[model samples]
Target: MCVKCDNCGAEIGLDGVCKFCGTVLPPREPVAPPPVAPGWGTPPPRPVFSIPQPRVPVQQPVQAASPKSRWVAILLWLLLGYLGAHQFYAGKVGMGILYLFTFGLCGIGWVIDGVSLFAGSFRDRYGLPIRV
Candidate 1:
């Protein structure tokens, strides 16, 4: 009869041990022992398995604003800079409204605004760093 190796599950040579994992086996036959002798008792209990915790990766949020848009900024400056349109684009709503009501009355404020927008000193509504 044939026997399968317990270590690798391979078919073993009928006369010897398995070649793959070097597992030994006894030939099929009942052994007539010298008899007698029996002792010891139950085996000890096995330890329970302890599971390890998995690590999680951290994620960063992205910035939402661009630093400046020259064309749009210039348009606001030309058309509504008197109305503080440029200031509004730069997230300065309060100042924009001030200019809107004043109608560029001083003219000086609008000129400063044009320079601010061109220089990238402006920020978007979110107050985040502006991308080019």
Candidate 2:
């Protein structure tokens, strides 16, 4: 025997099911949709956004002054610069030898060394500035 499906209205065989629609012999109760909350028709509010700010760099602490004296180096450069006395005092042996041989690069290097010594930019063997 054959019967019609209650859900799809298709014909079924003796197994009590619809062949075309796959519906059972007896139809189940219809399911109702969930109830909507109040004001569900309105869309949600948009999210707020803000731009970031640039940050300032922090200042570093000052280093300790060198133990070598600037006045002593200046005096050596003034008196015996052609002989590289100031370079020897600053512990720059190679420059001292060069100055000793070349007469301070024909006196030009001697003048520049004196300028650097007075400007507080001359360094020692350890690379520390002889600013003191």
Estimate TM-scores for all models.
0.42, 0.56
Clashing pairs in model 1, backbone N/Cα/C closer than 3 A: 67-130
Tens digits of per-residue lDDT, candidate 2, 1-132, equal 345677787787777677888766655466797877888866678898987888878889887666889999899999999999989998999999999999999999998888888788888888889986
Model 1 ranges with Cα > 4 A deviation: 1-68, 129-131
Worst 10 residues of 1 by lDDT: 35-44
RMSD of 2: 10.2
Point to the candidate with the largest lDDT: 2
Q: Estimate candidate 1's RMSD in Å.
A: 14.9
Clash tally for model 2:
0
Q: What is the lDDT of residue 131 in candidate 1?
A: 41
